[model samples]
Target chain A: MDLHLGRITWFQGGRDKVAREEVKSLEVYETGPTLTFSMGPQHPGTGHFRMVITVVGDIVVRCDPDPGFVHRGEEKMCEYKTWITNIPHLERPAILDAAGMTYPYVLAVERLMGVEPPERAKYLRVIMAELQRICSHLYWLGLMGVFAGHATMYMWCFGDREYLVDLTQLIGGQRITHSYFVPGGVRNDAPSKVPRELVKNFRTYYRMMLGKDYPSGEVPEDFRKYVLAVCDFFDTRLDEYYPMLLDSPIFIYRTKGIGVLKREDAISLGVVGPVLRGSGVKSDTRIDEPYDAYPYIKFNVPTMDGCDSYSRMMVGYYEMKESVRIIKQAVEQMPEGPVKLKQHPVTIKVPAGEVFASAEAARGQCSFYIRSDGTDKPYRVKICSPSFRNLIAMPYLIKDVRIADIPIIYWSLNYWPVECDR
Target chain B: MSLSKAEEILKRLIEDLRSRFGDRVLEVNVEPKKIVKILVALECIKDVAQYLKSEWAIDYIKGVTGVDLSKLPNNAQEALEIIYHVGSLSSEALKGITISLSTKVSISNPVMPSLTGIWKGAEMHEREVYEMLGVSFEGHPDLRRLLLPEFWSDGPPLRKNYMVPGREGQSG
Candidate 1:
């Protein structure tokens, strides 16, 4: 048996290394460098994800990602449920990117049945998707910060994330699994004051952090002092974190040259969204393959040629900022229209054909390939998740990096185990 | 970039494949249908896939879906048919294709050739098939349970024989 990293690859020859080598020699071209080791099914910093790693000395020789540990078999289960019922079903893959994942599934169904959502609904989906993007990046930043041992950043990122989660709950009446996105449109429109609340929350969050002289007259002195202290702590931590991560010799040494996936390699591997962009390939499903309201939005697809863990991490940071920009654009361009298409309940019958729809999910491009036999329910639904493709590239990336940097590399990838394992 | 050129190219390629491998080419009707269905025999899966990749640059293996045909089986020995939906990233015009292949193995003890050797993307999909359908891949390196845990004794839950009801917290 050949074990790569901590994940099992191929149990080839019997327990004899010599026999394995002899057999391996016959398949000369396919013979990858012999590196043997275990990474994890459970380990801190790998997030909820753990992969057994194998390295030939300092280089990753092979990586086999052990999935199914968190497998819920979401696709098969969706088959048993009605079209409307599966709204919650699709959201479970990446809890942070619920709306982004759900939107494509909804769009595929709607597109198949030729159902058009109202103008307000389109604007609403964009708002929710962008909000979800921000929230997803916050989770990634928090996880990345925690893995980097920056507890302060983790707390701040997650704390700031709560503000957005609160906004989501206000819109959908739920936080994480906001089954708000349904076929044809959103399940419910945001309340008239909901936008006001959203703007207020953004102001409160921004004033607490980004403002120079944060409206001190608007609040009491003691409360002002407390906010200042919390802000100071996070501001100081952010100041130290960037230089420590990007400029420090030790940190740079670990991240600078680790997990290098080139541009062509990324594209050919079907590595989508930011992972491909991080490798200097300006390929975003939103920009290159525009869908939803993204075609109207203007944002740069950030790219870096470094292709290492640090580059990937930097890519995420910049992309998060871009997502914010998108949200702001979407909000500013909001127009007056009904938020949902008028339709009879249980009357949607999708055409008897498979529709492959993809969206720019936070991690990468998550593509949903749905097969419907002209029915309300899908004949078969196959989700080609971003993490699955990104996970496959681990062997190539983690080849020679030290076991100590394994968690760091994995964290920098921003991989979700549930997403990958699904 | 003209329509006829693409069609002519496909026509010439089909003729070559038909001549090279006789009746093994079950069907090669590649008209611009909604779903690009390429029906081929079990034995010619690897060959036809290579042809698709080399000639058409159908590189991206989009999704692998397994259909349980045990109830519709004319023979008990007939294996479940698996569909490999291949997508080409480079070809903007021709985005995705559905290639259906069938093999008759056994219901009691099912086994099929592993396509992981040809399409590296099918590794997870094959593991899924093995776990859900009980169709063992002959030369698959790691043929363990995928979605289900190692302890779960429920025999290949997706099989027609198995009664997979609406269980609580079963991911729905």
Candidate 2:
């Protein structure tokens, strides 16, 4: 409802309206009275990205986002590596959401190669993907807290994110860049050794302290309880974030009406993920075309009508809750089976065909198009990253706000620079 | 997914295009995935794009892709293939489907009309195609190098003919 349309009018040093009207061109002002400067590929706000902004008085008149600082020619590089060997570097662009990044690529390869992972592998993949979604949203929220001038929110978010990170390390066998996905299935099934060890160690400690051994087995009271408990703890923990950031007066004042992208503008620019959902669009790849275990497990795609920075942030905030619900369901309903169909040789040749695979990533929609020409190496692989698709929305929104509010609007889109340049 | 669900949507759309332009629509392919492919001649690509946007309501694009077809075995035709995968945001029935419209241009002078006039989101994608594959869009507003550095001019790196530096004779 609130549409500033890229000309914010409030400023401490307001130039006379009649005098400002005479200077019609932003380019003229750039050459004359306006200040034109390039912000960072190094500026903490625009990580690995630069933007040239021209401002007249306190209002921005023109913006040019330059985002090739982290370009590594990822698609070109994929041509050289075999399909299985490409997973590690393919996910490097979005290391925080590695599972979400490579899910579609692996699915696409599986579709082309005509192989299906076992049923349990599908559930495991969904659990890891949703866990990483919550992890990724928390990282974004922590950085956004700092951008909103609230260090406490930053500390709270990063601290809580560790629980999910630890849970992920238990299954994924790594901390951050988990190349856990393979063509037919995941790299390995969920490990019982780590959790069994933890439960066994806890049983010994409880007997020594309380003088009772109680009951124990090979499964050791099941690992599913631990995953469910984390989900329950996070359910209440995420509720706290809503009031701390969303309901607080100072936080709302900074983000509520800033960078309002109207519904029409959002659709025309082809924005995806939270940026589009925040603007009242009922579209998500997971719901529209259910992938992995999403077809079985039920979840909601949260939508907001505010069409502002606050709406985008709230959509991401609420999506984490849905992700938690999904993780709980996947763990409970998982079937017992082998993870992979069969072990193929290192050099697997896919039949000549083309496939397009898409997944709902933490940031938004990420898709991969693979064209195989009956060879181990692919003829082409095109990555359509959500950050790159959302790039147009930045210059469109940043044209009207004050210089101080730029970081608030920029971080609200949750645009990661490395992902965009890839 | 049930393949027929996607196929049902693909059938109606392909029928509409075939009826409208008889000879211009060259090829139609339905893969096992949730995608529909239509290959049109080079000249009618703009008309097909305009028709899809105005009549069929395939509003937003996923991405644009280009493939060099020079190095394929037993292939004599020299050309660069371009593909545009489109979907709808407003229409729920058509949300999951992707219709990739492809067109080919001569490898020597690969110039085609840009679709940015209709879908403004393709501006950066067109620039990227220009930078990576040397396939220029004639009517594109800002057709410059997007991700490539300013000074590099060896060749379009994505093209099959352009060998990566220090990796010559290292064919897989």
Candidate 3:
């Protein structure tokens, strides 16, 4: 009769024993023709994650989300590597939002080393972070569409995301896992010049977004204008998704009132980012704890009162636009200076101290608690990933829902296995 | 940037903690301005956690981390430090204040009371701590290996004593 009764054993050798024990505990297990099977990693709906749910007459009664399929022991690995080398491995956890993943770690290490990065480096960090947020949200949007059976929405999102991914490659020198951030500052500075032909194609749009009237011949080398043009384009392009997916009848029917997380429950469970915002809370680590240029940058924390799958979808959707706004503001306000510290990042040994820094990643707040022992390496690096925190809410939300409605509920929580397991 | 507003809350938080906890609160260290670390006794961890949740509106725990000071190049005492990174979401006054409610326990019998009752979100985090650090949370409902495989019988991997496989000869 209790929710927190016992551990759900991974159905291995003694399948019948697991089923029988489950039968004794749950009414669904006791009922006629009950099904006890894992919606495992191989499934399209569940991305390298599993939820062993027990069902009776199409209603899921018990859900035990089994993650850790991609467990690489990321934190353990951090101890062995130098602070500079840890970036590559740490960023791998959440590759989609690599800058966001490693930002807090870099911040902690920077504090430990007692070397503040330049003002330009800080602004560049903000720009890269927002770009990564846009890319991650696009990837998520594509997945949400496919899960809801809107194939066109998936195609459109994936295709459009490539543009941002290219922009990432241009800056970070990598597409997915950009190990661009270091303890001192960034590994490299964002490009100073933009391609002539690229901007020439969208010259009018660039002019309007940048608010300059020059009879274009040479296609201004202003990378800020190029970035702002892309941001403005995305800000306008986001409106198209409303008609394509949000306003659709099937999308509304599936998500409008489904997977409704209450405001109280959201706070108590410690869910972050869009899921928290979707439930009517404006608690963003970017706003709460201003890191890098977040304090200087002006943007709104979007909150939705719907508190359902649709609201979560809307929250993430609006966040993409807000991210664009942050990028534009950061790009325009960025000053000229050296991006990295004068001291070599590789040679620096941190003093003995403990510090924790958290940043608002694409999904939620990704935090790092670093305890350095006056050495090149860390004593303990505790990574509190948002996916891991959000994973606890799976069983709480997945209960008492139809088996068909499982994917929508699970995806709405934004649980990525690698990030959660790492 | 409202950080000053958050600082006022932190000062009040420290004052309230001292008034309530007294000598049980061993130390209170604020890293720069945002993070507050409070060291307390192992026996009163659950009570202190409950008090923080109810009184300070610090309902959610960001994480539960266990650090083995036994392996550190420190002085006499051998102990495992359990740090609970708690923060607020319900009350705006307490927002952005990252409170580390930490306690030290003997390494041989690394056990502490679970805060899952106080913060239900701590269930998985406590489980991870149990598996990784071998620190038993006495009242944890389901204390099984979370991220680790079932075959992992070797002592908790995160401890400094247990050398990570290939990292033995490396400069860690």
Candidate 4:
């Protein structure tokens, strides 16, 4: 009756021939009713990822998430590149929020170099990062809607996301991989006319699209007023968003109690971002370890005790509002100065030291452990991405769930394959 | 918990470890703003980990980072250092503190006790360390390659000595 009474050498190959033969002799070989199938690496539901699942009838009994389809050896490749050049490719893992992905890396390098950015540059970094967070969350929201078979939701979310993307382009000159974040600060400052342009665009958009007149032109000297006005405009748009998606009967029915992860399980599994917050753990790196302009901003860390797909989705929705608030505050309080330090990017030398820096990215806590050996390039770079940690919970959450709920639960966890595999 | 309270708890934890572990605890370096790094003998790592879990309530492991020290000229023993970044969500006092428990094993005999029994979250990270750094984690339930292909016959890619196919000219 004791399972561990004897060593199971059946998997040891030819060396365990006797044990293998004994196992074959004792067993009655009969095919089980369970169906085993490999879903993805090319499937529509899973993006460039594969998971082998064994199911009985419609319920999944076992699941194994096989990532690494997009592994480009980013960590190892960092050793060959200079401190500054690595920023562009390092953000590729989670391109939707490029600034968020590279923020921690820049922080770690700065710590090693013993230099701090100017106050203006810090606020600029915060603005760029918050914008990236909104863009990334919108992208995930669209994907979530698509996974649940709501194409209109996808169109709306993606369509709304372009405005933020345009703003990012106006500042960084690139839409996706901005390469905007550097060691001492961001690459450049916002143009002098950006505040007026933003205010005008938001007012025009609100009046034309939402049929609501946004009061503007008050306190034009403060960029924060315009940013807050835009955020207020989005607050109105979000009111239209809830009843259409979260309150829909189908959406509620499909995600209400499905793939429930308890708070303990979520913490032990190392899940982060909205998934961790949804399970009622009040842990966000942005709040816990205030970095950039996070300390100056005031916003509530949204949490839900439901621990279900719906709760996670709601967390994502509420977080977008909080990001808007943070951006507005950061813009309002930002001091005027040079956006970047006068240090040269290519020839910078960092002293021999190691530091680990973490930031709350859209998916979760993105951390970078960089070890420098008094050189321009790093000795070793270790990236612990949120998607990789959250992937550990997939096998546990997928158990006993219907096969149809697989994509819903999967996307709800926000497991970005590229980030995980990196 | 406030920063000062977290530091007090960390100091008390270190003192308790010193009393309990005696000479087995090699070094305890506390960086109040960063992390608390503790190096222990390979033989006493499991006991130290158990004490941290049961006594200090540092339950969850944030990550398991393995560094291959075989390439270093001074490390003639050719050791592999594994640092376990363990913390807790259940305990409010210990939430702010991250205890980094590290142990080193000779590369020729790279075997260490797995912490999966203590923290189930360490499963995937241990598998990754096993495959990437070639450290055999004893008592790990499923010690297979987590990221690499099954048919991968090359030496552990993360090891400093493992040369990439066409990039021999570049030095680390």
- The top-ranked prediction according to lDDT is 2
Candidate 2 chain A lowest-lDDT run of ten: A10-19
Assign candidate 4 its CAPRI class. acceptable
Off by over 4 Å in 3: A1-33, A196-221, A343-345, B1-5
Provide the lowest-lDDT 10-residue window in model 1 chain A. Answer: A4-13
Candidate 4 lDDT score at position A255:
90
What digit string (tens of lDDT, one per residue) describes model 3 on residues A210-281? Answer: 466434444456777667656666776688888989899988898888988898898888888889999998
lDDT of 2 by residue, A66-97 (tens): 78899998998888888888899999999999
The alpha-carbon lDDT assigned to residue A82 of candidate 3 equals 81
Instruction: Identify the runs in model 1 with alpha carbons over 4 angstroms from their true place.
Output: A1-40, A53-63, A194-204, A211-251, A343-351, A374-376, B1-35, B69-79, B90-112, B138-142, B165-172
- What is the fnat of candidate 1? 0.16
Interface RMSD in Å per candidate, to 1 decimal? Answer: 8.1, 13.0, 6.9, 7.2
Runs in model 2 deviating more than 4 A are A1-30, A193-221, B1-5
lDDT tens digits by residue: candidate 1, B4-67: 6655655665677678777886765452423345556767777777777777676665556665
- Ranked candidates (TM-score, high to low): 4, 3, 2, 1
Better of 2 and 3 by DockQ: 3
Residue A64 lDDT, candidate 4, scale 0-100: 76
DockQ of each: 0.18, 0.33, 0.42, 0.42
Chain A TM-score vs. truth, each candidate: 0.81, 0.87, 0.88, 0.89
Best candidate, DockQ? 3
Better of 1 and 2 by TM-score: 2
